[model samples]
Target: MLRSLVRALSGEVDPEIEARVRAVSQGVNELGFDKWGFSPDAVKHAMGLYAWLYREYFRVEAFGVEHVPPGRALLIGNHSSQLAYDGIMVATALLLEADPPRAVKAMIEKFFQHQPFVNVMMARSGQLTGLPQNALRLLQEDQLVMVFPEGARGGGKTVWERYELKRFGHGFMRLALEARAPIVPFGFIGGEEACPSLVDVKPLARLLGMPYLPITPTILPLPLPAKCSVYFGRPLVFDGRGDEEDAVIEGYVEEVRSSIGALIERGLSERRGIFFG
Candidate 1:
């Protein structure tokens, strides 16, 4: 019955898209649910909606998606637009544009887990809790995992602070080292302009148990139709055991951050305008 509902919600899926999504590894059980709650059917159903946003609304242009090497890989990208559309676009590009469609297991913030029904949606859509253990397990299984090192700091960026990367957390770097997975740094441009924020209301956010409440020109941070670009760089490999010293881990984190910064700069230079692509 539930499966029927999912299919009904999906309506008619493109046969080519259905084939590509089925090609990705999902590891579901008889009931079509993976141990982590991923459902290939659910992912397929979601592709149509996100694909429209990727192709039409945002008009996202992705480059170097081929850099996403097969097997275990860590995708690191900047997070913004309060709503996390950047992550969606990045994941969509990998699924729709990569040579072989790959499912991205995004590491999600704990704050979102508390929202009503959000946990179920996130799991069914192939997202996992942002825990080191979960990410490690995915990497060990040769799955592609996506992480945003900037966390809430980057998500709360105001218009004035757009494109400026906040301090990165070193956990992703250490995780990559431990899993022996290559890190692919990608930069997402235009999120700030899409959902420009003027200020973050910390007091309100605290009252609501939210990370930060952003005040945008539209009052809500709904994304405007902004042309966005995502640039994927070559894979980066670091030498060290995952348990390196804090200083060593910090250095490695800095290198990845710099790579993403450079990618962002490149995307900015290539872009003609916010809404003009």
Candidate 2:
């Protein structure tokens, strides 16, 4: 049924991508849901749906995909594009490009739960609620968890603020320390140009209970075809107890933030043009 639904939504599912997705070890139950609500079927469907955007539309160039180590790992990334397409692209790359493909379990905002169908789709597609416990549990289970330390602030950036990472929260650092997971910092470029926000309507966002209400030239959240690039860095491990002073934790967070920032700069230097690179 899910395959049929996926075929209906996207008539073009790459055979190689399909084989790679099936090779992933999600450990789902008979009903197709893992303990944390991951459905292999749903993930495959999502891959089919987003594969086009990742390929023909955005023409995403993924570098250092092999940097993602096996077993437990924390993927820290810079977030942008109000719609969170950066996360989607990163996940897609890991699933399609990595050797012995991995299905990344991304931590998402709780605010999305209020939306109707979007909520269910997210959970089934292996996205977890952005809570400390959820992230810790996934790490303990040896799953690859993607986290955006900048949270909604990074996602709501205006065009001018693009690639300039917002202040990163220290919670992810604490989780990594606790789980003994290696951190893979990555940077995503071109989302800001894809859906550049001219301004954020504060009053409207407050009323709607959203992070930010962006006003773009499109007037909608649709992303333009901007050449996207994701640069994955080597895994970083910090040695310490998870229970550390606030200042100590902040240092780890800063290190990861700086690494992501450097990646962004590298991508910028290599980019030939926003729409062509």
Candidate 3:
């Protein structure tokens, strides 16, 4: 069981894998089990690695954790870094740095979810697609749901559009209205510099049916060591039926977007340097 969970989360392992497996397995056993396909052992192992990335490598400083209310809540943020490092950092902050240490169910892109190894690992880590049905169900169960409204567009951003937000989908807004979950907006600083997208080959991307293909300097499958900071804003709540008009719901979406945008600007200003915070 331990080996399986580790394999699902990480692609490779070595002699030290046994020690990690033992540690995570023990932690999972103490918690019993969960219904969301969440492998506590997998989460434990992943969190341990992310904690190091968040605390030491990037030297992250998280703020406004208190804004996340109890029960079901929507965590919306500006996504960048060419990868899901922004999402992982947000999850790490709440899991290891928050007052009560809450678990977040991140919404994964359907296209990316089809990858051979990523599929199982994402499910075992309790991440679900950003579908209305999935978000509603998770919120109904009183769980924290994190989403990047910008979706693939945000992840594929070029260097110039780093902090600039793209058009957001109304799906998250509708789900929040249906679940009556408050929205917690967050911003991640220094992520745009971590992997600057210099160019995107549109022809190749179209052939592959992907949004955009970003080409960056970091050739290796690793993010350059860069300092990071995260800021969570006050939660916002909207009273509306899920069937509301697009225009009406968009008003609320814009508000959340604006909040996150402001946080991003503030974080960028506060950052001391790119690699050193």
Candidate 4:
């Protein structure tokens, strides 16, 4: 097949190949291969890859995926743990849970766009710069958009700030209003557990040109084998109300923050599994 040929031609398997495979798989699954006489090989391959990564590296448990509807939806989740594993877990869960299996285009920080090969892989995987223009376009196309309003600082916060949702940016609300998309608030727990910080090394990080270096209780100080969970909240509808004002948008942002916080609390309190088990 052309896909196999393309994969063979590439000397090193890149993330873009995986992205294409995932997109094709999603399309096949949506088309109901059993009834349409189509093949789900790509989807199967992508799922297998994800399963292997998750099983080998992290234990992920997701709930409330049924909350994601078939339409333009904005997913706002708490970004904890310096590595941003929470975002990956949530995206994987959405891909696996949706009946038609929608492909989510995440809004990434501007810095990622400057990375050497990472930018290419992210673009091929449908990631876009966290700009208003791209957000509007995706919403207009009825694509699922995943955004972390707290940005990298929030996600990279120290262990002390774990589970504490930060002040959310208004961009998410504005995008929802512009695209008329329902907002889905979700929470990620145990991401910080994977990479807990033991000391404050901001000064050293500045010298090394790195953001922050977390000292965890590991031999090589890698991300701990923590049990990760993603909890999806009920959708918040726009109600056709034009952007009332900046004040109104701030109010809505607060509501979203509160909702996500509540979900995180619920997930953390109700979870019964260990990080490695």
lDDT of 2 by residue, 99-194 (tens): 989889999988897789988988888887899999999999888999998888988889888889899989899899999999999999988899
lDDT of each: 0.88, 0.87, 0.80, 0.72
Ranking under TM-score, best-scoring first?
1, 2, 3, 4
lDDT of 4 by residue, 74-117 (tens): 99889867765677667767765556566677888776778797
Worst 10 residues of 2 by lDDT: 1-10
Best by lDDT: 1
TM-score of 4: 0.78
Give one digit per residue, the lDDT tens place, for model 3 in 136-221: 98899888999998988888888888799999988889998989899999998878887788987778988998767888888735
**Which consecutive 10 residues in model 4 have the weakest lDDT in total?**
34-43
| lDDT for 187 (candidate 3) | 90
Cα RMSD, each candidate:
3.9, 3.2, 5.6, 7.5
The C-alpha TM-scores of every prediction are: 0.94, 0.94, 0.87, 0.78
> Per-residue lDDT for 203-242 in model 1, tens only?
9999998988988787454588889989999999999989
Clashes of each: 0, 0, 0, 1
Q: For candidate 1, which ten residues in a row score worst on lDDT?
A: 1-10
